[model samples]
Target: MVYLDNAATTPVHPTVVQVIQDALINDFGNPSSTYRIGKSVKHALIQARKQLAELLNVSETDVYFTSGATEANNWAIIAQANKSREFGEGHHIVTTAIEHPSVTNVTKYLETQGFDVTYIQPNEEGEITVQQFLEATTDKTIGWIAMAVNNEVGSILPVQELGEAAYEQKLWFHVDTVQALGHLELDYQALKCTSFVGSAHKFNGPKGIGFLVYRTYQEHNHLEPLLHGGGQEGKMRSGTENVPYILGMVKALELAKKDITSNFEKFEELQAYLLTSLDSIGISYEINGDQKNRVPYINNLWFNGNIASQMLIKMDLDGVYISAGSACSAGSLTESEILKAYYPNQSERWSQSLRISFGYQTTKADIDQFIHTLEKITKGKIDLWHSNK
Candidate 1:
């Protein structure tokens, strides 16, 4: 099967799999136990935490593990709100309309609790600018949270700009780095955000594992723990650690970071090849978001009609896998909220979008097969894909 839905999730690398398998059988003791095996496992967790901290350029104490990006995202928003209450700040939050559902839903729930949230809309680019964030901010606004890179359209948000703005305004900042993990360089210090969340599954690692990095020096650090049990993660996030998955996750991330530059260049080459192939095949498509300001990993496009669901079904049956939008909402056949936020009042555009993402193992052969399959699928209806503009 030719898989192009990497933005949704990636297959685990062989090395990561091996690491997890080994730990599962050999390092089965719980980190919270005081016995010899437990102490050794606990030491491994400590070392893994330190290793990840070095990769992100943060202190080891700041890294806390969770189930995945979803949990981390939920914790970030709620914890930030709780911190706002502690500081006596206004019940207001600043976030983008294109944020992951994990974030958007949390903000929506917060609104029900009397916390006003200003969701800044993207300007036809799937990107939120610092200016928009600043304009949305008020004296009552407690924090700003946004994804470092949009998962659907792959638009790279202005994280550096927002981080600086958050610093200047003394407001908390949380970045969802799920899409940014393997695609973009992760420097917690350089990014200057109060906190950032990551998922291991996004970068060819095991699923059911992720981490959150919150700066200890920041005022937001004083917020109470999001989870309470077993006193794990310094009482900030409680629960016995998934030791094996933690080791595998750290391994996968380190591997990605080790070759980030070369991988980025390779993805650029692949992206250019994909567009050229589409042009050569006479399959005209309008890129769904900012053409030049997106990660090469994801290519979201809007074809002629409301055929995203149909094409996705056909592609899956034919062994060439792709997706309409975010995997969490892909089954619903509903219009993409992300696309709607980018192209307001354009239901046709939102409904006819496809998100094709690339992984580290993706190759020119995969792209060739995808273009060939797409051409075969749209043969008689080729003119429909041939846009005037």
Candidate 2:
């Protein structure tokens, strides 16, 4: 199948798989052990952390490893909330409505625990303006949470500018950079964020391994351990380190860092091909997010009168695969919150929205084939709508 669901997850690279296999076989000793084998494993773990730090352009001391992006996001939010509670300083958290389930759900959980959460809505183009974000901040607001790049619509948020605003307000800023890590060049020194989260799988790395980057070691930003045990990852995360997965993640990130430029060029070619074919089909479509600020790899399309799910099925039958909106809300197949945020009171029109994403494995031919199938589905849907009328 011509898979277009890179946003959901990606297949692990062969080189990464090989590294993982090697680690599991030869470096199975516990990193905490004092034996020789343990010493070697410990060294490997440190190297992995340093490699990840290099990729993020942060100090190894500031980087903490987690199971995945969800866990990292949870830890960041809860830690900041706990700190706020302790000081009675800033009990309010500011986030956007277009955030992923990981960020949104964590914020919702915080609300239940007596923390005030302000959910800011994005503009019509799925972008949160710096002014709006600043307006949301108040004296009680402790943290500003937003994504560097939206996972569903792929719109690039002005993270540097937003983070600066949060800093100017003396508030902690945390951004979910899971989707943006490898696709976008992140200059950690320039971002000026209090914290950031990224997943390895999004960059063709191994699953179950991710990292959190924080600016300083201030106790207010200090996170209470989410998992309690042998105290891995600076006592912030517990349980034994997944050394094999960590090593593989390092390899994948290095690969992405080396190849980002060419990969972006390839995505541009695919986008051009897709838009050209869609235009040729005479399909009336609108881009869901701000094209000028969107990542090159994703295009959220709104076909005027066709149901996205039905169109997805048609494309699947023709050996193409795509997602509706958020993969985290899999099987629900409901109207997307991101769409609703942009076009309020237009729930009926959401069924026509489709999220098409590409990845390292994607090609021009794949876009051509998918577009051909889309045309057939669009024409058939139009005829059916007219018939019912």
List, residue by residue over 161-219, the lDDT tens digit for candidate 2. 98788778877889899998787887877787888888889889887889888665365
Q: For candidate 1, list the clashing residue pairs, or say none.
A: none
| Alpha carbon lDDT at 328, candidate 2 | 79
What TM-score do all the candidates reach, one by one?
0.95, 0.94
Stretches off by above 4 angstroms in model 2 are 381-389
Cα deviation of 286 in candidate 1 (Å)?
Answer: 0.6
